[model samples]
Target: MSAIFYIDQLPNRTIDHDGQAYLFFSGTAYLGIPQHPDFHQLMAESMRRYGTVFGSSRNGNVRISVYEEAESMLATRIGAESALTLSSGMMAGQVVINWLQSQHYTFVYAPKAHPALWHAPTVTLPQLAFADWTAQLPGQLSALSPGPVAILVNSLDAVCSDYYDFDWINQLPDNRPITLIVDDSHGLGVLNNGRGIWPTILQKSVDKPASVRIVGTGSLAKGMGLPGGVVFGDANAIQSIRQTAFFGACSPMPPACLDAFLRADALYAEGQERLQRNIKLAEHLLLPTGLFHQASGYPVFFTEHDALYANLLQKNILIYSFAYPTAADRANTRIVISAFHEVADIEWLAESIFG
Candidate 1:
C-alpha cells in the first residue's frame, strides 16, 4: 500500500499533493461533472434559486416541486414508469428493502451484491463464481418452494469492471411473484449511453412472466454527479416505496443538486461522449498489455498487480487503491477514467504504467 495523499480541492483530471501534480483517476465521478466549470456554474445558479439543502421530509406538507420533476425526468431516461429521489443511493435501496421486508418475501442475493442492497444475513452461494451462480440460479430459485422471492444484485461488479448479464431472468420459474432489486450505483450515467441498466433488463425480461418485478436503486453522485440517489420502478413499486416509513421520515436530496441535474442535459451528453472516447482510447492503449480487466463502455479498469499502486504513485499518477465496503476487505486497485481526462492524461497514464 502507498502512503495516503490528500488534496484540498476536488480532483478532476489532475490533483496536487505535497507540491506535486498527478493525473487523477480515482473516484465515482464517472461523468466528471463535479469539477466541470459549466456544472459548477449550474449548481451555483441553482443554489441561489433553491438553497443548498431542503431539510424537510418528502411527506411534509410543504414540498419542493423539483423532486417530482427530476424524478419524472429520471423515470423517462431510465425507461421506468416512475422514480423516487432520496438523500443518497444507500437510502434508496434501504427504503425499498424496508418496504419489501413487510411483504414476507424470501430474499436471494447474487454474489458481490453491494451492502446497500443487503438484507440481514443474505443467502448466497458461498465460493460460487458469478458465471456459475448465474448458471445454477434457476435450479436454486425453483427449489425455494411456494413463497415469493426477491433477488438482489449489483448491475455490474465495480471492483473488477465486470458487467452482469440478466438473460438468466427469463429462465426463472414465474409461478410465484419475483422481485429483482439491482444496485446500479456504478451504472447510471456511465452505462448504456447514460441511461443505465433499466432498458437493457427490460428487453431481456420481455419473455419473463408478469409476476417478475424489477426495481433499481443507485447513487446519482457516481455517474450523474448529483448529490443524491434514486429508485426506479413501476408506478406501484414507487408508490409502495413512497408509503414506507423510511421514505416518509428520511430527508430528500438537496433541491439545488436536483435542479442542476434537471438542467444539465447538454452537460451530461457532452460528458458521456467524452467518456466514451476515453474508454475506447484506454482500451486501445492498455488492454493489449494484458494487465487490466475492463468492460466495454465502462470507465473502471482493474488490475491485480500488488505493487502497481506504489509504482504509479512514484510516476505522479493517482488511482484508487484501498479496501471497499470494509477495511477488512482486500484492497481494490484500479484506474477510473472520467470525462475530464484528456487524451494526453491517458497517454501519460499508459506510459507511467509500462514505460
Candidate 2:
C-alpha cells in the first residue's frame, strides 16, 4: 500500500507498478489528447516548428504569435473580453490576488476553494455550506457596501467536480457590485461542451454587467492538456495583469504547449462527446454499487469508504486518493474515465468496484 511506484508510457490507461498492470485512474487529461495520432503528429510538427521553451521575456521586443492565437481562441470560447496567459495556475492566482490586494478588497471563499486564494484579506465562515453562502450573499453584500468585496471560488471543484451554481450568482440582488473570481482549471476543456464555465456564466449574467465582475483564472495543464495558466476577464482587468503581473518576469510558457493548445479546439470537439459518454458509463455502473457517487458529468467520485479504495486496488485498479494540495476533507478515491478508455475498460473497473 505504501511503496507502489508509477511511470508514464504505452498503455497509458494502466499503471505498471511492482511489475503488475493496474488500471490507471488518476490522470487529468480528460480528453486523452495523447491517444490521437493525428493530434500527436500536429504536436510533433509544432515542437519542430517552435522549438521547446522560449526562455525569455514576452514583454521584450520579441513576441510570439502563438500566445495571442491561443489566448484569442480561449477568450472567444470562454466569453471573456480578453485573457492573459501566465506561467501556471498558482501564478495566475497570485496575479488575481495582487490585483485584488492593490484595490484592498475584502474576500470571501467557498470552503473547498483553492489554497492560493488564502493570500487575500479573507473572512472565512467555514460552518456555512455553499448553499448557505449563496442564500446569504445579497445581505452580505448590503452590509459590506462602501467597499469592494470579492468572492473567489473553484468554478468546478477538482475533487467533487460539482460547479458553483451560476444561477445563484445570477439571482443576486441588482446593482450590488461584487467581483467574482473563478478557478476553472478543471472546467476549461470538459465543461459546457469544452468552452468552460465563463461562457455559461456570461450567458447567465448578461443583464447584470454592473452587478458582477467575472474573473476566471486556471492552468491550461488540467483540461486543455497544455502548459501555463490564464487570467480572463474584461479588458481592463486583463490588461492589468498582462502589462505588469509578476508572472511575466518568469520564462514564458513553453511554446510547445501553446502548440497543443492551438489545436485543442478541433481535437476537443471530436473527443468531448465520447468523453461525456464515458463519464455517463461510469455514473451508470458505479452508482448502482452503492460504493460511489457521480459528481456532475466529470468522472471524479466522492467516496468515504476505505473498502471501496482498498478493494479496487486489490482488484488491480489504481485510483487517486486526495492529500495535501487537495483539501484534506476532499480525501477520496478518484476513478478517472478518459476519452481513450475502451467500453471494456469501463465495465471492468465497474465490476471491480461492484465486487
RMSD of each predicted structure? 1.4, 2.7
- Cα lDDT of model 2 by residue, 181-270, tens digit: 888888888888887888788777777657678899887776676768888999988887676646568677777777776776678887
Q: Largest lDDT belongs to which candidate?
A: 1
Where does candidate 2 stray beyond 4 Å?
1-4, 8-11, 34-37, 120-125, 171-177, 209-211, 245-247, 324-330
Q: After superposition, how far is residue 94 of candidate 2 from its true place, in Å?
A: 1.5
* Model 1 quality (TM-score): 0.97
Largest TM-score belongs to which candidate? 1
> Cα lDDT of all candidates, in order?
0.88, 0.75
Return the clash pairs for model 1, or none: none
TM-score of 2: 0.90
